[model samples]
Target: MAKIPATIVTGFLGAGKTTLIRHMLSNAKGRRIALIINEFGDLGVDGDLLKGCGDATCTDDDIMELSNGCICCTVAEDFVPTMEKLLARDLPPDHIVIETSGLALPQPLVRAFNWPGLSTRVTVDGVVTVVDGKAVSEGRFAVDVAAVDRQRRADENLDHETPLSELFDDQIACADMIVVNKSDLMESEEADHLAAVLKADARRGVQVIRTAMGALPVEILLGQKIGAEADLGARHEVHHHHHHDDDGDHTHEDEHDHDHHHDHDDFESFVVTMGEIADPTAFAERVADTIRQHDILRLKGFAAVTGKPLRLTLQAVGPRIETYFDKPHAGPRETRLVVIGQAGLDRAAISAALTA
Candidate 1:
């Protein structure tokens, strides 16, 4: 009974996890792969984006979605059943990949592979953590990168970790490989510095690679054969006791008074659909203005441009926006983008700006 190899992809919001997964699927090279996506919002934007990749391996049946809650918190009710179904398939996939929500902790999810029913059927090949290079360079997760670096160097035990920093650290500390995504957004030196910082935070001998648009060789991602399920202790050092029990009633928030769900309430997401834009540049300018006005963290989706046969892809990480023609629209040409940011975002005003 050869066990199916599974890879866990975890990272913060807007870290390019889906991009990497899509790339892997498109270049699977004859390997039948199944994906499990755990989305933070009910919109299922990530799952929808992957499905539009137009790859045979990315069929709706193969790509499962668990949107009710994070897999780490609902492993018993959500993850177990999903894995069971995939494994029980008459023609089971050659590999499985689990993409966790930005706010998820990978350690807990990886531990779920140790369950009695799944332990023998599937093995955790590796935990790949995708980090936003630009975000790290800009100190998005930390209050002060230099000061934190100094404090960490000065006294390893006398460090104060913010909730965001804690989550970032836990993800990095548990990664078998750290991918500094969006490297092209930063300078060579900037990417190098972030990579160095991540290398130090990760477990000893963990590989750190920089990639643009989550591009990397498929061989580098799969076939690691690390058996992460058994090596969790050595790889996942931080937040060891944060995982909940099999009873399924308790959550990470309950264990640490963390309130991840309530904390995430600080962020809000809304979709805006409009007629085709005549000018992609002008529309992007308007989107940038709205983001600046409301401090929007991420905005992405596809837009239909006037007279263009292909759909225009739209993505914004803070004020930096990236646009390109992805593929032809399947149906009516319309500009649909989802705006995500901190709570109290002026949805009406932002919608007005897009329409204006």
Candidate 2:
């Protein structure tokens, strides 16, 4: 039997990973695709959104959610068994797509493929990293360009980095391909420049494609045949240091304590639920205001609207909100969203404000 090819989709929060996967499943071209989605928060909002996509190639049964924790941290307990079950199916899928948590590091998850049973059955087709072009353009991750230019004129070596930038760099370093998504929010020249900068930073021969709304064809995204796991030595990690035993079990060696969950100590996420919303526009504005007020990084979920048949989907990245009705209300007439941001979030105040 031929080994199954699995594509790993990774990126920061709100980088449009779900959107890109939806596009791939919609245009799967008669191929059966199985999805393994990992989410940061308690609620599985990403899985819920993708399930409503109504793509035949990727039905609800084909979608598996690992909301317990980050996939990398729970590989032994969550991921390995999931893959074994899928591979044991009477009619296994033609391809598998794993969407890592936005806060996840792809290297560890990629390394999981080398485990005993999975090693012979599956090959990593590619690791695609999605970049938020709009956020990058606004200097959300890296140091300010103006400050860098000033230091350069002073003949000073720039050596400033943020936690978010370190995470972004790790993602870029392990990627087989990088997609600069949401380019529509940027000027044509600015988008091209961003892509150029990313390409320069990335490993040799990696393609950086700029896109709006995560729009990319299936051919361009898949079929890389990279077998990334076999070349793990080439991909460097900025945040984690791991050593594997002879049995293939891996352990982390870092400054943080033994608890690996603390790797993301800088970030946190929580869910907010409320009754039906009266006005969609006003509700979105309220949500946006709450985001701005709380310094929330990413907020997304569905809202049950008054006198509306379809469910309202709201997604906000840094106070820039987008809302639209996706499908009809399925189970309940209530609003639910997952709020993510840096640690020390004012959850009590945010919940009160959004539900108000």
**TM-scores for candidates 1 onward, in order:** 0.62, 0.62
lDDT of 1 by residue, 1-356 (tens): 99999999887656777777877888888899999987653347777778887888889999998866656667788889999999999999999999886666787788899998999999998899988788788988532345334433343222233345666888888888888877777888888788888878777656677777676656667766668889877755454323341111111110111112111233468899998999999999998898777667568889999899999998875566889998999989998999875457888998998889
* Model 2: per-residue Cα lDDT at residue 186: 85
**Distance from true position, residue 265, model 2, in Å?**
41
Kindly report which residue pairs in candidate 1 clash with one another.
none
Tens digit of per-residue lDDT, candidate 2, span 1-356: 78899999987666778778877887788889999987553356777777887878878889997765556657788999999999999999999999886556788888999999999999998899987787787888422334322332332221223245676788899998888877767898998799889979988767677766565666557666778999998887865422321011111111111212112333578999999989898999899889877767568899999899999998765566778889998898999999976567999999999988
TM-score, predicted candidate 2 vs. hidden true structure: 0.62
Clashes of 2: 0
TM match of model 1 to true structure:
0.62
